[model samples]
Target: MGSRNGKILFALVGVCLLVGAGYVVAAALGPDETTTEARPQVDGAVLAHAHLMVRAVDPANPRLNGRVYEIDGGKARRRSGDLACERVYFAGGRGICMGVAPSGVDYRAQIFDSQLRPVHEFALTGFPSRARVSSDGRYGATTVFVSGDSYLQAPSAFSTRTVIVDLRSGERVGQLEQFDVTKDGKPFDAVDFNFWGVTFVPGDSSRYYATLGTGGSHYLVEGDIAARSMRVLRDGVECPSLSPDGEQIVFKSRVAGSERWRLRVLDVETLADHAVAETRSVDDQVEWLDNETLVYSYEDDLYTVPADGSGEPQLLVRDASSPVRLDRGI
Candidate 1:
């Protein structure tokens, strides 16, 4: 019995290592990386009654993608899971914004009804792999690649663009280009380089953030659509996530030459930050439970801590992967 259990442990640990490795590679090679806002008050009555919308990927097809699940009454059951849910978020309990990975190079944004079926087949096309749904459920945004011929061997650069779509009308409002993150906006010239992990500012319609990597150094830049410009927020901000109320940003940072991932939270207004967690593997895919509590995926498990960078992180789930999604019951 002991031997059997040991094998199981080894297998699970190995899986986590693989997933962590993948994220590390992506972050190292991808574009480089928010401040946060104050959280709103909620009743204890609300959190106890909260349920979530999530993906219960069929472990049988770990690499093949996953299906969607709804967490109700502390039980996670299959809601659909057929869509390869990359981003699962809710807006006012009326609609869902999902980033679906249909293929390696392409992802689509789709809106869904309460029943978990596609409300429209082609709501937004050429959607970036990384995206988030708006708080009201009416708009969706993402980062996508703009490929072209290159004169040198520089990798392809992807532009972080926001495609605003009205869920009710099933129409794309428009795709505004936010930032050009290709090593000072270099055009693609080779197959070895690319981009990933695009996150938009929470409720901030004019701005978004992405990691731009080239020549081996990664930088995080914020995009301003109205100005048609991109600005580096911090030199090495990575794995940024907003708090539930969308006022706080949680991210990992590197100090000088150290490759260690140290988690930090910043005040959006004052730019004051509180450091919270330290991780050996690259920590990414964090979310907010409320404005006070934060959740992030580490070693194939999801853990939570205070938003102001306080306390030891408590485990939420294991055997899970990034692009972890959470609803604030908003």
Candidate 2:
């Protein structure tokens, strides 16, 4: 009986050793959590005119999370230090990176400096969708998907919450949902009102524009930061981005009966818009590479088209999104 028990003990020990070995092998083959560099291959000549900040998109898993990269002189290099984001934007020497918090369960936003080092971090209410900084780097805005509040009862239904942030102090300025909105010089309030895609005017940080989604209509609403009021300018505009010169506004015009959108450029003064050369539906807050050109992401790649509704779409950077033009010396 003693010899039989000894044989059984030896068998159990062997099984444990095999299990441990398998775990070690699996650990070695798993995805590396420490690696943050994307090392994208891009043409230097295309980016030589201006430095741009973008987030790398994983081809296999295109979640919003990725390492931040700077494209300059046709080269793409991952920013040094640890800063990975799901949505990233930089302007006027400040940047906002929204992603999952270190706890791995909640979302957060980190306000960073010109060196890409985080100076302040704040909690985010939901999944990060869009992030932007004012041209002068004085203020920032973030949009998140809040699941339970969707007016649409579909399975994929979701609502959005956009908030303005004071960049210097890293404090919450105001929530767009709480601000008063107007249409035609009268108060406009609705239970289904949702706001997103905030774009600050080029020279005026106190004034901004955003899309107000309500009653199945998307309106371009101009807002005043100090007054906490927004006045609807026009309808059918989403993700409005003003040009560097602040004369033209580029936005995504949603297609009828579809989730797709076509890029369109509008005169800020005239409010007349025309389709851009790119026929594909883009669902991004367009970025202006310059006064004459527009850049945006589609299918995990960056593309540029002329702001004048001429020229075909050109691929700018591969496997990158959240393109922020760095022309302001940041």
Candidate 3:
């Protein structure tokens, strides 16, 4: 496995050097960019659980590169760094960053400890899209577009592959495609299976929830990490995010007969679904801000709504894409 990983990294580096050498420094970086020291206090119970909510500060200014910033209270605390990435997630007390390396061809996953100490790095395939960490921070998952991110047509249309990693042991837990799948108590196989938007169940590193696409349709898949297996739960589910209590999952659902997708929540045990109050077309993996509200990014800004399908979606943070609140109060 070491040799195989080395070869893959070698190939990724070669490709990036050939195609993205001039652009790697110009991408949006993960939240673990070099640190900046500033402490500003803000307010609200939503942000009270943690010390900082980290995200890319200047996603709009490519000239500034991927600079890391934190929201303390509600004010911006800028950090220093030029590292570029699309997203970052904190789990197991570690920061996992997914971004294109200096060589654009190499999608890299860089892990850092709570003190910002470097731990491990993986040269991955495709363009970085989303990064997620299990509640305990033992497991990390990332989604990358393997193809079809460009304007020019390609062989694969919007193909995505989700990779899970064991952060503590620094081992790749295998991609979602390798999982054995069963549908309706029978084995199911497909030549066109693609997965993305994985949400992990807390206190259980062995299980996760994700969106699986096959035969031109999408379904929510309940995955068993230890068994390397998956089972289809329901149709029309995309980007499932489990609530803090692990009793519910918020996701985006495709409306019937149209391309529009609305925010919705599902009761994992009862299989009951409720459409969130947000009626706009949202294409994001919504995050749970406490047990009642769901936060997500739409049009470069963050918005929140009630999980029970009650209240309208309201803006939380502007010019931010990834929003995370620490479970422990500061």
Candidate 4:
């Protein structure tokens, strides 16, 4: 009996040693590779509620064209679909993509939900350019070039029509030229009037800001959607984007006697103008990341500068354009 008891003790000690050795081997090999539960920290970070800076990459290749870059410096993933467009934006939990139809003759406006599922679509009149969605994503606006509407001498340059759509109802809101104008509180009309660069007021779908051109001059106009009317506010400003707080408007202002435009900000309350930090001439429409930082695309690369005109331009993403931030917190 004494010999049997000693043998049992020796067997239990051997099993304990084997269990300890197995634990040491597993620890050295790191976590289990089979489960996401044991995935690396970087893998989990890609799943967060982060903003995506999307842009067209590889202009020559049709297969790997557009890319969606994670804001936290994670890997950029290519977007799948026939979504060939100059710009794409997301707002109010919806994605708006503007481009030419596959037929190459008809322009198209495609709308998608947060999950990127097709929710709405429209057939536009001409080649699509810039696109903007209102803060709440209820209204979508685009600038396109129509042939007959423009002067024959400069068919493309002279004719630009801004179209606003009711995304909720999937209906057209008519061209900005159709809106009645009250310049200096009096009825204003012009046969050559044109409108582009729409910026909607936050929480107010009826109100918006846009650039109106008449008699070879551009003016900033305040628009009322329900009334279908506009009031001219200021001149020499084009492609205005309202700040997040709704207090200021940033736009491209033509430099006198030169064919160049500089980014400038206007105080909506005082109608005061101030230049942004970037000194180089900017040709594209700008977006506000917040009240302090302004973003725009320069030569196919995305850049940001301080709205207060303080810091130098910082590169946000390479080979990207149409930087739109999703106000998920709203």
TM-score of every prediction relative to native: 0.61, 0.87, 0.80, 0.78
Tens digits of lDDT, candidate 1, 50-136: 355544333333322345555445445555544444445555333444433343433455667656667764533432234555554
Ranking by TM-score: 2, 3, 4, 1
lDDT of each: 0.47, 0.79, 0.67, 0.66
Q: Name the top TM-score candidate.
A: 2
Scored by lDDT, the top model is 2
* Candidate 3 local lDDT, 1-330, one digit each (tens): 111110011112332342342233434344443222222223333343333444553433421224345665556665434333457677668767766565443567787666555588888676666788888788889887554433313333345668889888778988887778889999877656778889889889778999887765788999988888899998888889999889999988877766568888889998789888999988778887778888787765677788998868776666565666554432
Per-residue lDDT tens digits for candidate 2, residues 1-330, read: 111100001111332343343233323432344233555558433745757899888766555357899888888877756898878999888899987666555678999999999999999877677888998999999987654543345433456779999999999998888888789988888777778899999879989999988877889999998899899999999889989888999999988877668999999999999999999978789999999999999888998988898889888888888999887455
Ranking by lDDT: 2, 3, 4, 1
Q: Flag regions of model 2 displaced more than 4 Å.
A: 1-36, 44-47, 150-156
User: Residue 286 CA error for candidate 4 (Å)?
Assistant: 0.3
- Cα displacement (angstroms), candidate 2, residue 208, comes to 0.2
CA shift at 41, candidate 3, in angstroms? 14
TM-score pick, better of 2 and 3: 2
Q: After superposition, how far is residue 80 of candidate 3 from its true place, in Å?
A: 6.3
**Clashes in model 3: which pairs?**
16-105, 28-85, 29-84, 29-85, 91-137, 92-137
Model 1 residue runs over 4 Å out of place are 1-50, 58-61, 92-107, 122-129, 144-233, 255-260, 322-330
